[model samples]
Target: MLTLICQGSSFALHKMATGLRKGAKLNYKLMNEQGISLDTKDNSDNNDDQVAEDTRKDSVFSPVKSKAQKSNASSAEDDGKHSLPEEVDSDDQEIEKLQRELETLEKDEAKLKKIKQKEELRQKVVRKRDEVKALRDVRRVCIMGDSIIKHLPSIQGVSIFAFPGATIGKLSFLVDSRAVPLADFNFVIIHVGTNNIANGHSLQHMSSDFANLVASIRKFNKDIAIIVSSILPRPVDHSHTKSTVQQFNFHSQDYLASELNFKFIRSYRPFCFRGDIKRFLFAKRDGGLHLNSEGSNRLRFFFLRVISTLT
Candidate 1:
């Protein structure tokens, strides 16, 4: 009986040991097959990224490159850049790609530079036109207002129909009867009413006076084209904070289209900051609100732009 019991115990222990061995082998197979590892970095086609970087480099180099391209090409060759590794070699094919990129950048830069140069040239032509034009047989342009344009110096062809302290109601030397043939002028620019606002002229009174001025000019020059440059922008300084000037401009702009020849020209975009003189329109010679040579040139260019559009 004792021997049989011991034999049973031995068999049970052996069975348990065999099961543990099988379990260890299964764990090893799973770990080996799955190969617990990670690929953390992304590897994608880098061609697009590299090409964009190359294009940017070309633009920066192309500015001075236009004059230097031939020299650089030769230098690059002598420096053995042509012998770079296959990955970055300046081989015939790669050199051709760089050349094409450089040309594209140079062309784009040239176009922008040309536009700026053209704007400057346009100013020169307009002034020449204004001078040559003043000497021509064109009708006179009589401006009536305060000092805004008082310093324009008498244009050769046109008579000085205005003076300092001229108000909305009456210009110092300007007579209503004289303005009858006004519409016959080649062009006209008017700026008035800052004084009126300061003088306590009500909106209604100012509007009425402006209407009279327009009517008088149209009556005189029946076929004259009106180029109404808005009131020169005023500075944002407290002394210039009056909104009535803007109100006057707004009202005039609204009424300007009523006449066939009346065309409102915004004079400040090129020289003034937006429409506010305080921010940008400092080109006036006085170093105040008015325009100086730069401002005059800007205006001259503006006229050309309009003429180009109309003709």
Candidate 2:
């Protein structure tokens, strides 16, 4: 009786164990059918949560991302490809583009430097030409006037042409006759109006004669620099002589101021005291008209100073 009872209990325990095993198998199959993974630690709800978190991270950083990074991220999301190698390629392309731009900038800088060098060379050429022209202008000078200009000592580049009793009209005629020789010189000094004043020629007549004389010179050589020396004051022979001489010099200076390439030099200042002519500067033999040795030396000194400025 005890053995039968034990066998019945064993059968009942085996049936219970079998039912539990089948139930466990059924549960596993049902869970798999519902898309729940037992091997991995995630269910459908966890997967959805992880996907939402990843999407949030991408959206939060989208604005700050480079276009290349954003494109790589988009492709990664579309095709499941990794973005690291593509990012490296983008960096290399950017580096190459920057290098090309730098090369272009360097080329532009070199071209600008060459342009500056060319401009500097051109300026040097222009300056050299001007210097040569100035040198040529001071090379040969001709002093033409009455006997007063003849007393000037010989200079290397100077030529003297003097007529003892030359009036303004007489000098003008001589210049017209010798225009060819006068044209060869770069400068002409005229010192002849003393005779015009002494000969009692009216100031209007003298002025007209002087203007015609300059016109004749210019007709021969327009490039020549003409210097006109004022008449020297003589001892007061007549009260009007000194006043007339003063008027002639003032008119000459005023007229020549407007004339191109003409300069008027006052020659009476050194030989005159307060208002009268210095008696020592004139030779008594010529009735205080011609300059003596001391007077000639002083005149030469000032004349040479004027010539120095031109050179």
Candidate 3:
């Protein structure tokens, strides 16, 4: 009874092994098509066990099973006859699709980065251009007067053009360029008619001269405000001077107003009325009829008030 049981158990083990071999062969064939390899394997013990099992299966169901397994393996090996496993083929197709999608995504990411960098550079250039333009459009302070403005300290943003021996007749020629330049000015501080007075020019002539200057300025800058400056204090030394400069300040102001509507910066308030003529108005070295540092301060405030009102 023990010998019979041993034979039956060996036959049963051989049958199980044959089925395993057939399944393993099918798996290996599928793996081969997918380029999967287990070539580095050492199956010496399994091969010995399979040989013993095959010998025992000869007395069992070996003949029938071997014939069936051979037919199945032959059919599986023939590419024209049998199809690849559905699960394996599906996995390969999914992997290929995912790989293509990943590549496309990578290319799109690179393209977006390039576009973003280019946009940033364009904005930087535009900002730089605006900064340069702003710097060039600086404020220009235009001075329209006699030699007084020319000799004053270099005020910020200030430019000067004063006719030394100019009267109303020469004014058009004297300020042909500066009239337009000053017309487009941030501030036009004018102090003329002094030369007209010193040279014994008539009040009527002075008025005409002032009117011409205003007319020329208005031609260029229509909105430019005109400041009709009254004659500054003439010292006692120039008392023997030709024209009635003091009378001109009082009467010519009304004359200038009638000719045109403009503001008048009267100097009689600070320098001539309350202060010394020679000490306060003219520099001792200047000798000519011109304003000193103290006198310039009065003119400065007049322009300042003009600026404040406009702003």
Lowest lDDT 10-residue stretch of candidate 2: 57-66
Give the per-residue lDDT digits (tens) of candidate 2, residues 1-311: 89999999999999999999999999999999998768655577788898877676568655566567789889888664556678889999999999999999999999999999999999999999999888775668888888886677666677878788988888889878983377778888888888787778998898889888898898888888899988888763535588888998888888754653479998778888788778888778978778888888777777777777775
lDDT of 1 by residue, 182-300 (tens): 54456665656656766778778877776677677666655566666665555533255446666666766787446434777765566445454543444434445555655555655
Query: Which candidate number has the best TM-score?
Result: 3
Among all candidates shown, the one with the greatest lDDT = 2
lDDT of 3 by residue, 1-311 (tens): 99999999999999999999999999999999999876644476678789987776655645545666678878777854445576678999999999999999999999999999999999999999999777645454566666655555555566666666656557655666654375456456677766776677777777777778778777777776666667665563366542477667767676666667676667556664434454566666656456778667766665555545543
lDDT for each of the candidates?
0.61, 0.81, 0.68
What's each prediction's TM-score?
0.43, 0.55, 0.58
TM-score of model 1 (CA atoms): 0.43
Off by over 4 Å in 3: 1-65, 79-140, 178-180, 240-243, 274-280, 286-288
Clashing pairs in 3: none
Task: State candidate 3's TM-score.
Answer: 0.58
Global Cα lDDT for candidate 2:
0.81
Order of candidate numbers by lDDT, starting with the best: 2, 3, 1
